[model samples]
Target: MRFDILTVLPGLLESPFAHSILHRAQKKGLTEIHVHNLRDYSSNKHKSVDDYPYGGGSGMVMMIEPFAVCIEKLKAEREYDEIIFMTPDGVTLNQGLANQLSSVKNIMILCGHYKGIDQRVRDLYVTREMSIGDYVLSGGELPAAILVDAIVRLIPGVLSDETSALSDSFQDDMLDAPVYTRPADWKGHKVPDILLSGNTPEIEKWRFEQAMERTKARRPDLLE
Candidate 1:
């Protein structure tokens, strides 16, 4: 998988892809992440990428020219499966979406800043739009990072135990079952006896029941 991220403040994106699973994914050649500075495509003498909104809104709007140029340039290089705009009003992202995107070959993510990007840019170029949640943020950089992390971790071989991702909380629309580590009997607390019985079938059943009960208590909406 290949991800191209376009942002005015590329610096905000540096640390995310440079560490942990994302960094390992790149090293293993399972994925490639590229960050493009929107200002590089600006035609203005001062290399500005934003301007005052036409209707005189309180916040400035990102200009369309540079964004268009950047998107066009990338499209000319290769076809992208999706051009996604990160915004508050977009479809709320979920695990299923991340799983689907993990199989895609190429994608472009546009990070809107200031107030937001011009609507024309979105209409002309974006194929999809996504939001991490209903709340707003100062910019889309953090959301883009979140999206990339979620998607990349699902790619094959990205995680040491490939099956681990399959059992993540939202993979089956149920939260993960409780887990215990070494020192199973710490202080007065004890690991469930079923887990130590060497009975895989019974343990699996117990986990499923626990997961259902926890989801019912904490997130009943997912069950529906």
Candidate 2:
């Protein structure tokens, strides 16, 4: 998969993909992540990409010119499966969405700053809009990075254990069963006998029950 992220604060996104799964995914040829500075597409003499709202809003609105040129230039190079704008009002992102996007060949993400991007740009170009959560943030760079991470890790060969993402929380609409490692008997606490017994069927059943209980206690909404 390929992802092109457009942001005014490209610096904010530098660190998120530089470590861990995402970095390794790129190195292994499983995915490509490109960050474009929107200011580079600015038409302003000072290279400003925002302006006072036409209706006189308190904060500056991102001008459409920069986004227009950027999107057009990208489309000319290759087709995009989705052009996603991260915003508070868009559909909230979840594991299902990430899983769906993992199949796409290419995507474009635009990060909004200041008040937000001009509505015209969204109407003209964006195929989808996504929100990380209900709450608002100062900018969309973080959300863009998060969305990419979520999708990238699910791609085959991105993780050392391919099944790891399949069992991630929310992939099954249930939380994960508690896990224990070496020193399971720390402080007199012992590993569950079923796990130690090497009874795969019984152990799987126990994990499912534990996951169901945890989900009911913490996030019953997922079950509904």
Candidate 3:
């Protein structure tokens, strides 16, 4: 998979993709992430990408021209499966959405800063819009990182154990079952006897039951 992130503050995204699973994914050629400075596409003498809103909003709004220039240029080079705009009002991102995007070959993520991007840019170029949650942030960089991480981790060869991603919470509309590490009997806490037993079938059944029970208590909406 390939992601082209367009942001005025590209520096904000440097750390997230430079470490951990995302870095390894890039190293193995399983995915590619490219950050583009939105200012680079600006025609202004100051290289500004934002301006005060036309109606005199309190916050600055990202200019449409630079964004359009960048998106159009990228489109000419390759067809992208989704041109996503990260905004507070977008559809709430979910595991299923991440899974769907993992199959896409190319993507472009536009990070809105200041107040937000011009609506015309969204209407004309964006194929999808996603939000991490209800709360707002100073910018879309963090949300974009989260989105990239979710999609990249699901790509084949990104994780050491390919099936690990399959069993992640929300993969099956249920939270993952409880897990225990070494020192099974730490202090007074003991690992579930079923897990310690050498009965794979029984253990699998127990895990499923636990997962369902936990989901019922915590997020019954998922089951529905």
User: Which tens-of-lDDT digit does each residue in 98-131 have in candidate 3?
Assistant: 9999999999999999888999999999999999
Where does candidate 3 clash, by residue pair? Answer: none
Query: Candidate 2 regions off by >4 Å?
Result: none
Encode model 2's per-residue lDDT on 1-224: one tens digit a residue.
99999999999999999998899999999999999999999978899999999968599999999999999999999999999999999999999999999999999999999998899999999999999999999999999999999999999989999898999999999999998788868899898878887889999999999999999999999999
lDDT score for residue 152 of model 3: 98
The 10 consecutive residues of candidate 2 with the worst lDDT sum are 178-187
Local distance difference test, candidate 3: 0.96
Model 1: residues with Cα > 4 Å off, grouped in runs: none
Question: Over the full model, what C-alpha lDDT does candidate 2 score relative to the true structure?
Answer: 0.94
TM-score of 1: 0.98
List the candidate 3 regions with Cα displacement exceeding 4 Å. none
Return the number of clashes found in candidate 2. 0
The positional error of residue 82 in candidate 2, measured at the CA in angstroms, is 0.3
